[model samples]
Target: MSVKPESASELFSGPFALGTFSAASGPAFPGLIDREGQVLDLRTALSDPALTMRGLLERWSAVLPQLRELASSSEPVRRPLEELRVLAPVEPRQIFQSGANYRQHVIDLHVAHRAPDDDRPEEERRAEAAEIMDRRAAEDLPYVFIGLPSSVTGPYDDVTLPAWAAKPDWELELVAVIGRPAHQVSVEEALEYVAGYTIANDLTDRATVFRRDMPQIGTDWLRSKNAPGFTPLGPWIVPAESIGDTGDLQLTLKLNGEVMQDESTKDMIFDVARMVAYASQTARLLPGDLVLTGSPAGNGMHWGRLLRDGDVMDASITGLGAQRTRCLAEES
Candidate 1:
């Protein structure tokens, strides 16, 4: 299928295609994807034998200009997107996830799980939660947690439902891929360090999110979120320049073809720049580091429906790309 390239003015910033491609000639290796949904062997394009996607990110300041020219230059030897295997854009060195960033999503969660002993009107509870969120955004810092890089998997890969996770859930997030080394950056300049944006389904085990014995320590992200294939990421990394308003994009997810999560990034209590800036205050973000800007509600936990074997998730973020993942049970 021939995909017409977006117009020159409509092109994604640097709009470089970065992913692993597999063809009949050999196994999968990292390459550049073009506007027409085709792959460009990076070695042939950059004329550098050591330029992998991660390498490109590490040198993004130098490579972006070249990519901009390459994207518009005469068509090079290309391979159809469907004919090759698409892997994760890059194996990120660090993964940071923002929690409770979506105002409405968090409010809905609190309202839904109100204490049974306290009899309060839903309307009053919702209003109170909204006030708290607004206060948090104004005065409190965002809640961020670390995730294991090993949990990463391809966008098209199957997600293994861990045997211990009885209530596997999905959280479709907008991932900001860092292109520059950032330490103590301001919100105004945070986007400058971002290479691109991609899709991430932050799969969680709802049953393990909290600990009765260790409530003081708070959520146990390691066990609740970081299992092999727990983070299914990428079909493409759309350059940040190509994206217009970071907070206005639509994020959607379907379970078995039914819309389970459909919301706009505008609902976030803290926007992308804030999330990046906040994460940077604690850690030096290097190229290829991923900061997931939380999901916009409609999670499985809210719907009273959790993932099961044979379930398929179709996740997409406006302009970034879409991903389809099938669920399978983990063998003991």
Candidate 2:
């Protein structure tokens, strides 16, 4: 733990999906680890035979043939049965994120911030000091957030809105994962430390957010951000190397397959270079660390329609894959 780990390879050193991927000896794509467990050993299922760390490090994205070959004859580092008990792969740390990284989100939140008296009453106003922190800090890209690691539900997992959230909204965000240690990096060369991309929904409590009369309140995004199973990530992460370029990608949000929001990464107020450079200027970005760019438009708030218990939402980004979630509202 004292010395820098020279042996670690960004691709192989996972916050992996846990189960064996279909192409074990090749790249591991993210997927829902069904409660019943199926197609879990993707790595072992690959045609390639050498399903070890050496194979993965050297082969990164080579797509060698026979990569999907079953590894029934091979030995696993851990006992097979023991592996099944392991929970789904998730980041060990809070997934870091930025607020208003996108142009539309900034304009949207800005309007909300300038509204009249808060819908919440006097006592409730004092209580939600956490939510108000966002209004003041809603300036631009490089806004950081410490996400709920436990809140990470798989791509197809159920997203539940607490009974108290009157306006549960979905915000589609593209998340960047840090592959290497980047401290005080320059925007000119920040891409070197990136590992890959994934999808994140910055779901918020809109009812409390757009209150027209009051000043913004609260440090806790707890009410507005951290709803149960609110954060959905995975489907799979495209290796940063595979991504080629971070800008100019298409981002979209849909409800039951109907497009509600369509925007391009080019609209991002701060590009990846500026974002990574700014974040690293003061804080250290470690492996598995996430830099969540803020969401684009087409959220429920813009319509005044809130997420209901049975509503389904999809957050998709080009190359990053889409995460589909079913909303669950706590009922009395």
Highest-scoring model, TM-score: 1
lDDT of 2 by residue, 253-280 (tens): 8876678778988877677777777888
Candidate 1 per-residue lDDT, tens place, 1-332, comes to 11211221122334555676667677556676776666777767888765667888999888888878777776578676767767787889999999999988899878866766968998999999999898998896899999999999988888899999988999999999999999999999999999989889999997888775877886789999999999998877787888857878898999998999999999998999999999999899999999999998899878999999888898888887688889998889
Each model's lDDT:
0.84, 0.58
User: For all the candidates, what are their Cα RMSDs to the real structure?
Assistant: 3.9, 11.0
* Global CA lDDT computed for model 1: 0.84
Which stretches of model 2 miss by more than 4 angstroms?
1-89, 117-141, 208-219
Q: Which 10-residue window of candidate 2 scores lowest in summed lDDT?
A: 1-10
Mark the regions of model 1 whose C-alpha exceeds 4 Å error after superposition: 1-16, 24-27, 113-119
Error of 2 at 319 (Å): 1.6
Error of 2 at 93 (Å): 0.8
